[model samples]
Target: MADEATFTQLKDKVVEVRHYIHQHPELSDQEFETTKYITNYLTKLGYRIITPEKLNTGVIAEIGQGKPVVGLRSDIDALPIKEATGLPYASVNDGVMHACGHDFHITSLLGAAEVLAQEKDSLKGTIRLVFQPAEETHVGAQEVDAAGGADGIDAIIGFHNKPDLGVGEIGLLPGGLMAAVDQFKVTFKGIGTHAAMPQFGKDPIIALSGTVNAIQTIVSRNENPQKTAVVSITHIEGGSTWNVLPEEAWFEGTVRTFDGEARKTAKKRFYEIVNGQAASYGVDVEIEWIEGPDVVDNDPQLTKWVVDETSKHLTVVKPEPSNAGEDFAYFSQKIPSVFAFVGSHGNSDWHHSDLRLDDEGLIPGVKWYYYNAKRLLAELGKE
Candidate 1:
């Protein structure tokens, strides 16, 4: 943890940074101004700034040199949602808002930066503070890694603000905390014909309907019921007019699963259903699979180290497995990493413009960041 002086400094500056960031929010892969602001802040603190051209936008600052450097990541990009919070600090940028509490995330890391920079002289190892962009689209972590953000880093730690839990509480899961996500789209192509001539042409709509129904069996009839999996069709598009059939019909959705075997099986079966249905209907089927992050298999040792130290300073809860996917999964896959959630209970859910979390409520998260960093660095030396 930070010294008393450093702690006090962080405690005082947390709200100011959060409020400013909340007002001037930026979108993913386009955090130009936000990058400039954070760069200036870290530069003034005397940390060596590392923003490679490939990173596009984001800042990687290093303090205290040597082996076993720890990487800390916080996604800085905002979402494209109009603000409706009515708070004076609500998003000033129209059609862009930090609806997911990324503003709070940036503030917490900035606060941690203040504490770390103040005590760097007495620290044992390096702390690489990474402010990542494009997390909403799940490409920020990849961008950072491409920019060598994790090069030579011994381990990493990151956290998110949780709105369901009460203030001062944290949620940490040890294994399979979140699922792997796969989004897919299928287009059924057929000859368009007038509605009156029912037998004139193959109807892609009939084929699409059959395909969607059969795909659902991937989770039910095809896969083992004992395992967890999900297949949902969220969007479908077809003919524009009532009496005329369109030449193409398209549908898209996502699949979520905790079991790797189940995930593969689901995709394999989905393709089978689409192909079989298209063949029977004499239609052409085109499919695309957009692979996202895999299951968040939290490193057991790293998670234990975090919980052991964090439980001392704050209330830590064992969270149930979630289906929500995170790009941080990419980092955890490469190095020993732990993704945690800090309580910032609000009246509305995340991704909603009406979301609200008091600045005072997120202080424990700030303090936890310092504690986790110190403990991880200290533990690395013992190994």
Candidate 2:
């Protein structure tokens, strides 16, 4: 084990920061308070801070100087879920909560920032700490990247809090860490008539039902047996009353896939199925597709470095790829990156109304960040 005293001190700081953030959760692009807090903290640590023109709520702090700069990232946005953890430091904002453990991630990165700053004289190269916003909707990383966040970054590292794993364990996946997500909205229009005169009117509700059923076949029958694809119809709205035959029906849902080809194939098939089914039902249909984040692909060399270096501080495990998506995929696309998971030690699922995380897990996470930064700096020194 590492020195208990130093680790405990860092844990204490993590608790303070985490609670502070939990008590003041902000949503997506509106993270003014969160950004201010991070900016103030990092500035106090003697690091130069850069505020990009486009991203008002993002903060990038740099320490040390030289080639092959490494980057550390943390998302500062909170979900819209209401706080139900009942902790004293629970969110004061109604209908908003830190359900995703972003509070802990920011705290861990801040902890690393403090340690790295303190040891800058003994370190080599640079470390860029990014405090990002709007990760819940998977747009923050792209915004940051567009603003030249990783202009000359050699490697970017990030971590999510995993409630399924026990505390003190870090999970790293080499290849696909998370799937790509896409959302779609479809509407069918038809003639409306009395419910009793079904033969006289074309009901869009009927077409919607067929559309939903056929969309499922994209995953079950159309997709390859070895590949994973998810096509879910999460919402459907048609008739307002039982006595009326609705003129129009709307449905929306999301699709998730690991590979780009699978994602494209699923999207193409979805549009075809919806249009074909609507045409057969003699209804006019409109489909809108919105592309989302891509898969979180970890660079093999950087992932290996993370695994090897993290092993020196705590127990580490390789986890399977997750279906959920993250905005960190944007950073991974630009530079070498590895997004790992730090154990949260709770049973509650993420984005749930009652999600909670073990506060003690912050200790190991802080240590992991500290060691990872040190190892990166050391590696840069050798080059």
Per-prediction TM-score: 0.96, 0.96
Question: All models: lDDT?
Answer: 0.87, 0.87
lDDT of 1 at 350: 82
How well does candidate 1 score on lDDT at residue 21? 94
lDDT of 2 at 19: 94
The 10-residue segment of model 2 with minimum total lDDT is 1-10
Residues 1-383 of candidate 2 have per-residue lDDT tens digits of 23667677777678888999989999999999998899999989998897688887879889988776889999999998888888889899999999998998999888878777777776678889988889998889888888887688888889999999889999996888899999999999999999999998998999999889988999887788788888888998988998999899999999999888899889989988999999999999999999999989998877888899988778898887789989899998778888999999976878986778898899888887778877776766676
Compute the lDDT of residue 304 as modeled in candidate 2. 82
Q: How far is candidate 2 from the true structure (C-alpha RMSD, Å)?
A: 1.7
The reply for model 2, stretches above 4 Å from the true place, is 1-4, 380-383
- Candidate 1 is scored at a TM of 0.96
